[model samples]
Target: MKDSFCVTVTGQSLIKNDVRQIQHKRFLEVLDFLRQGNVVFTNFESTILGRYGGWPTKGRYFDYSRPEMLDALQTMGFNALALANNHAFDLGPAGVLSTLGEVWSRGFLHAGIGTDATDAMKPGRQRHGGHDVSLFAMDAGPGPGNMYAEDRSNGRPPRPGVNQLKTVRKLGVTKESFRTLAMLAQELRTSSLELTNYAQPDDPTAVIGENELNFYGTVFKQGSAFRRHVEIDPENAGEHLAAMQRAAARGDFVLAYLHHHHWEPGWQEVPGWVQGFARACIDAGASVFVSHGAPVLQAVELYKDAPIFYGLGNFLFHVPAEETEWSAREVWRSLVAACRYNGSGQLESIDLLPIVIGGEEETAANRLVPLAATGEVARNILQGFAKRSSIFGTEIAISGASARVSLAAARKVG
Candidate 1:
C-alpha cells in the first residue's frame, strides 16, 4: 500500500501575550484551512513551559498560556511545531527543557530543539499519505540564543528585559548563527578547502591569525564542548546528506525546513543564501525547501522537482505598538505562495493563502489566543488583515471585501 499525502507547512511570527490565548487563536486560524487529507503545522513561536524560565523585570520571557495553549493548537488543527526558531531560547536552557516537556506532554511533533547542537539538528520522520518523510532544522546564520536571565530566583533565572526590537520578533539567525554560515560560505567561495587566495596561509598577519575558538570565530579549547557559534559542521552536514539520500530512496518525498543566515536585517524581504541552500537541498534529493525569517513574501521558483519559497511572511505576531514594521499584516502584505504536493508523488501547485492573524476580541491580549475551532471568524479577519498590517507598512485601506495597501502608506522595510 503506497499512499501519498500533502501537508500545509507555515511559519509563525511571535507569541506575545498569554501562551494559552495565542495558542487558542492560532488553532482557529488553522482549522479554517484544514482539509480531510491535509495537515496544518507551524512553529510554536514561544516559550511558555513554566515559571522557572520567566525573565525578571521587563523581560516577559514571551510566555503564552501553557497546557491550554497546546490544547488550543491541537484543537485548531495544528499537528506539528518546529522549535528551531530564535525564541526557543527565551527562557534559556531551562526554558528549552520545559518546552521540550510541554510539546511532549501535548503530543505535538517538534524539531530544532535539544540539550545541545547534536540534539537540536537531529531529524524526525512522520507517516502520512502511506509514506514516511523526515524534517529537520539547521541554524545557518548569526543570531543570539535566548537572552540569559540576569539574576537567579526561586531556582529560576531573571529574564532579560525586553528591548523592543529583541522582544518583538526573531528573524531566526544571529551573529553566532552567521559565524556558522561564514564557514559554509567558505565551502561555496572555495570549491576546494585548499584555496588560499581569499585566506592567506603563510603571512603572520595574513588572516588575522585569530584563534578558531569555534564556528562563531570565537576562542575554543581542547576540552570545551559548546562554543558561542554552532552550525551544521562538515561532518554533520555530510551525515544529513547521507540521511536525506536514504530517505529519497525509501520515502515518497523529502523536505528540508532550513533557516539560513540573513544577509540583511529581518524587516526587508529577499533571498538569504536561498539559492545556495535550496540548490544544495535539491542536490541532496529534497522535494521542497521552505526558507523563513524574512519580513515579507519572496519569490518561489521550482528548482528541479522541489519548490523553494524564498521566505514566507508572518502567520502570527505580538503587537509591539512601538515597532511599526514588525506587525502582522505588514509582514502579510505580499501574497504568500504554498507548494502543494498533491496526491501524486510530485510537486503539484503553488497557490496564495493570505495568512490570517490577530484573533478575536481585537485586543492586544487576543493576539495571544488561538483561533476558534469553527474559525468562521477568520473571514472577518482577512477583511481587515491588510489594513491592520499596514500599520507596520503605512496607512492601509480596506474596502469592499479585501485590504488595499498604498505605496507611501505601507510599513517601511529596512
Candidate 2:
C-alpha cells in the first residue's frame, strides 16, 4: 500500500463499564500514525462472545466493550489480533466463537485459537502499508483458548483463546492447597479491578467464559498436573527461523508472538522454558518475540540480531499512577528504554502489551483531567525505554500516551 509500518498489537482488555470511552480518541491517534497503510493491531484481551458464559470460575469475566467493540477496532484500522492471551477463553468455546466470528467477520488476522494445539499454534498474517507480516502464536501458558478443535472423535487441542495446561508446578494438590490455588486462580482471573467482569446492578454484561478459579480447583483435585508437553517441537524453531529468513528476504520484517509470560519471578525468575522458547522462536527467523503473562516486564535480549521484549507491563489498564506505584510505571518505562527504533522515532520494534483494559472510569466527569489520555502513555513509554537502555546496552526509545505507548527503536548488534 504505502510503506511498511508493522504495528505489533496488544491491549489488556478494552472492555469495561465504559469501554467505549477511549475507543474513538485512541483509534484516531492510532490512525494518525498508521495512515500510511500500516496495520494497527492489538491483543483482543476481552472476548467478543455472542452468548454470555458467566464469569470465570476464578478470574473475573468481562465482555468486549460493546458489540461495537469490533466496529471500533475496524474503524480504528486494525488488521490483526492475538487470541492467545490468557483471557481469550474467559467464557469458553462459545466465547472463542464469538470473538473469532467478530474478528474474522470484520476481516482481521489472528493466531493461537482453534479446537486443538495445532489450531492454536497456527500462524496468521496481514498486509498493510506495503509490508507483509507473518505472526505465529502458541499457549506457552497463556491463550486464545480455542486450541482444541470441534472434532469429538479424537483428543483435540484446547480452545484457541484458552490455554490448557497439563499442570503448573506452583499449583499443589492438597485441600488447603486447593483452597489456596483456587484463590490464586481467582486472583489471576480478576487481577484488574477496572476490566474484571462483574455483573452490574443495571447493565446486561456477560459472565466470564473460563472459570480459571474452578478450572484450577479441578486441576488440584486431579493432583498436581503439568501440560502434556505436546512438543510444539523445538524443531519448529528451525522452521520458523527459516520462515523468518524468507520473510526478511522478501519483506521488511518478520515478527513472532509466542505465549511466553515474561513476568512472575516464580516462573521467569528461573525462566528456563521461556528462554528456550525465545531462543527457538528467534532462531526460526523472527525479528522480535513479544510476550505477556509475566504480569511484570522483563529485560530485552538480542538474539541472532533480533530483539526480544521479555515482557511489556500494563498497557491498557490504568493503575493508581501514584508515586508508590512508580515502579509499575517504571516497568513500562523500562520497556520503552529497551524497544528498538530506527532513527525515525517510529517504533521499529515489537514488545509485549501486558494488561490492556477498557475504560477510564475515574475521569468520566472531568474531560480536562490529564488521566483521560490513553495514548499519552506513549510519551512516558519512550522515556522509560531511554532510562533502561543502559541496562541492556542498546538504543531503544519509548513514548507514552496516557495508557498507550508509541515505541520506536533500532536494532544494535555487538
Best by lDDT: 1
Candidate 1: where are CA atoms >4 Å away?
16-30, 35-37, 51-65, 145-236, 260-268, 322-329, 332-338, 342-344, 359-414
Q: Give stretches of model 2 more than 4 Å off.
A: 1-5, 8-11, 17-31, 34-37, 51-66, 142-253, 260-262, 266-275, 295-302, 318-383, 397-412
> What is the Cα-based lDDT of residue 18 in candidate 2?
36
lDDT of 1 by residue, 1-414 (tens): 344466665556454443433334445444454433344556666666574564422253344435456665666566667666556565566666676778778766566666554455556567655656676554454344233222345885444311111111122344564466557756755665443443332211112133332222233322224322222345546666676777787753666665544534434434434566567777888877776666555545455655555555555666466555444444533332344555556555543344434433444444443343124343444334333333333333433323323333221331
User: Each model's RMSD to truth, in Å?
Assistant: 13.1, 11.1
- Residue 272's lDDT within candidate 1 is 32
Model 1 TM-score (2 dp): 0.60
Among these predictions, the greatest TM-score belongs to: 1
Model 2 weakest 10-residue run by lDDT: 364-373
**Candidate 2 structure, TM-score to reference:** 0.59
Question: What is the number of backbone collisions in each predicted candidate, taken in the order shown?
Answer: 44, 91
Candidate 2 whole-model C-alpha lDDT, 0 to 1: 0.47
**Candidate 1: residue 210 lDDT (0-100):** 33
TM, every model:
0.60, 0.59
